[model samples]
Target: MVPLRNQLLLGHAAEALPEVRDSELGDDTYVLDRLEQGRIAWLAGQDAGSKQAFAAADSRLAWEDEQAQYRLSRGLAQAGSLLTNDQTMAYRVPDYERTMLHHYLALNYLQRGDAEGALVEVRRANQVQEQALKTRADEVRAAKAQQEEGGDEQMRQQVSRGMPELDRLIGQVKNGFQNAYTFYFSGVLYEASGDLNDAWVDYQRGYQIAPDNLSLQVALLRLARLRGSPDELRETEKKLGRKAPPLVPSIAKNQGQLVVLFEDGLIPARREFFLPLPIATSGGDFRTFTVAVPYYDNRASDSGPLAVSVGNRHEQTSALVRLEALAAKDLQERLPGMLTRQALRLLSKEQLRRSAAKEGGDVGNILVGIFNTLSERADTRSWLTLPAQASSWQGSLPAGDIRLTLGAGSAMRELPLTIHAGQTTLVWVQRLGNRLTTRVMPL
Candidate 1:
C-alpha cells in the first residue's frame, strides 16, 4: 500500500502497485494508499466504495507503537473521530512526508469544518515550508557563486542570468570555457540586478572578445552616449558609421562645468525636454565635445530658452547655442527615457519611491544626472542616491555584495541592511557639502 501511494504520488496508477499475492498486505501499504485515495475521493465528494476500501486499508495500518502514536495524533486531527493519541500506538511516518500529510490533514479538517484544527496544521506546515524555501535559496545561491567563480566559460553558457533551466543545462555541459555569449548573458543578468557597472564590465569583456558582434556594437554605442563621451562616439563611429543618433541638444550657459558632454554641449534644464540634434562618432579615438548646461526641450509647443554661464571650458567665450526642434522618435533622446524606465523597474519599490520624491522638481534632470554619471564613470567608481525622509537623501551602496577597491581619493563607508523575503536591496549615494552619507534601507 505504501508503494501504491508512492506510485500514485509519482503519477502512476494504483493497480500498478507491485503484487504480493501470497501474504496479507501490511497496514503500511494499505493505509498509505487509503490516505491518498481518501483525499481524492473527498475532493470529489464521493464516499460510495472509497469508504469501505479505506476502512479495510486502515485496518492493516492500525497503530501499534511509535508509528501508532504518530498516526493516532494525525488521525484524531484528521478524522475528528474522538480517538486520542494513546488509543493508537503502532505506526510511523517519516518526517519528510509528515508535513505533506499534515497539509492534507489540514485540508481535510477544513472540509470537516474544524477551523481550529485546520489552522494549527496550516501554521505548522507553513513553518516547515518556509524553512525548506530558505534552504533551497541558500543552496541555489551557493551553487551559482561556485559555478561563476570556479567553473569555466562553458559554465557561463549554462548560467542564464539566474534562470533555473539555464543553470541546470550549464551544470550538465562541459564546465570550463568563457566565451562572448557567457559574458553577454552575464551582462544581461547584472543589468537586471541593478548592477550597471558589473553589467558594463561583462559587456566590455564580450566586446573585447568579439568586437564584430553587432549587439555588442549597439551596447558600446549606448554605453558611450550614456557616459556623455564624445571620444566614445568617435570610437564607435569607426566600427559603425559617422551618422549620429539623434539626441537632445544642450541649452546651458555654462556648458563646461556640466560633466555630461555631447556634440551640442551640456544641458542645464531641470525639466523634461527634447533636442532633435544628431550625434556623430568616428570609431577612431574618442573625442570630447562640450554642450551647454541648461538643455533645450522641444517637447512643448515653445522650444525652451537656453541659459549659458561664464565658467565653461570655453569660458568668457560667447556660447554657441543650437536651437533644434526634435521629432518624437529621435533614438538618442528617446532611448534615455526608455532605458530610465527599464532601470527603474529593475529597482525595488522603495528605491523607486525615493527617486520619485527627490525628482519631484524635475525627474528628467535626475534621470539625466544618473545616466551621465554611470556612463562617464564606466571605468571609475559611480554610485546612486535615493531620497531619505523629508530634507535628506539616502546614502550610496556598493551595488552588490562585492567589496570595491576605492579609486584615488575616494571615501569608503560601511552600511548594514536587512535582506527581506521577496524583496531585493537598493542603495543610494549622497554627497552633502563635504560629508558623504550612504543610507541603506530595505525594499
Candidate 2:
C-alpha cells in the first residue's frame, strides 16, 4: 500500500492504476481505490477516465449517505470488528475527504468546460461543510455518552497525553472540514461566470478562514469595491488593514485575471501508533497487547511558494490551504471515537482468547494470540495523492498572449497562455517531485 502511494507521488500513474483497477470494487477501500485511479488519470491528463472513476466514487458515497436502512448493517459490522480490528470493518469516509472528493469533481467539471457542473459540485462541497457543522454537537454528545458508558476515562486520558504533537501540527488550521482552498476555487468560478454576489460571498468566507492570505484578501477587496456599498467596502478595508497586493492589473484597463492553482508535493500518510493494553483473564491474571491507532507525524515542510514571473514583474504564490494541517485536525477530532472502538475491541479479543484457551488448551490459545497480533494493524487509509499544500497566485495582466515562468524549487517550466479581455484564465499546476503537470482553462 505504501509503495502504491509512493508510486503515485513519483508520477507513475500507469504503474499505479493497476493496483486499484476495477477488480478491487469489493474491497474495504473501494472509495480510496476510485480516488487513486481518478487522481492518477487527472494528473496524467486523462479527463474521461478521471471523470468516470470520480463519478463512481461519488455514487458510492451518495449510496452511503442515502441509505437509512444501512445504519443497522453498519452497526452490525462494527460489532463484528470488535472481535477482530478496524481493518476488518468497512471504511467510512471522513468529512474532509468527502469535501475533497467534491472539490476535485468541481475541478474536473471546470477542465471539461462546464461552469454549471463545477458550480454545482462546489456547492455540494460547501454543503458537506454545513452538514458537518450541524452534526458537530450531536457527535460530541455521542462521544461523551460512549466514554461514560464504557468507563473509558483512563483510556481517554492516555489518549490526550499523546496528542500534543498532533495539536501543534494542526494549530494553523481553523477546522478540519472547512478549508479555504475550496472556497477560493468556488469564488474564482463565480467571479469568472459574472456572478458577483456569489463570488463576494465565497471570497469573504475564504478570507475569514485565512485572513493573512494575500490572494484571499485581495480577492475580497476587489469584490468589495466592485459590488459592495461604500460602508461595506470601508469595513473590508478596515479588516484588511493597509497591506496591498502587488502588481495587480486594473480590470478598468481591460486586463484579464491570471489565476494559478499550484498543488505541491503529496499529503503525508497516517502511520500506526499504539498503546499497550492489559486485559484481565478469567483467572484474574492479565495479558498485555498492543492496541493500535492512526496518527499523522509532524513532518517538516521544505516546499516553498511558487515563483511566477512575466517580463520583469514577479510574484510568489500564497499558500491558500495547509491541507496537511486539516488532515491532522480531522484525525485529532476523530481520535476519541476510534479509541472507544478499540477499547471495545480489546475486551472482545480478550473474551475470545479465554474461550479459545478453554476449548483447545495451549495450542488454541497460541493460535488465537497469533491471529490477534497479526490483525492489530491500524487503519491508515487516506487520499494519498492529494497535495500536501494547495497554493495560488492571481493578478491582473494585459489581455493577450502571456509567456509565464513558473518555478518551484530547482524545477522550472515555461507556459504560453492566451489571456482574454475581462475574462479569467486559470492555470492548474500539480508539482510531483520534478514533474510538473499543468492544465490551462480560460473563462
| lDDT leader | 2
Residues 168-239 of candidate 2: C-alpha lDDT, one tens digit per residue: 668767668878889999999999999999998888888878777788888888887777477887888788
RMSD to the true structure for each prediction, in A, is 33.3, 2.4
Question: Model 2 segments beyond 4 Å from truth?
Answer: 21-26, 151-156, 159-164, 243-253, 279-283
For residues 153-269, write the lDDT of model 1, one tens digit per residue: 321332222111122212221111123433443343344345557656766865664555544555556556655779867876776664445444342111111110001111112
Superposed Cα deviation of residue 73, candidate 2 (Å): 1.7
Off by over 4 Å in 1: 1-39, 46-101, 149-443
| Deviation (Å) of 165 in candidate 2 | 3.0
* lDDT of every predicted structure (CA atoms): 0.33, 0.81
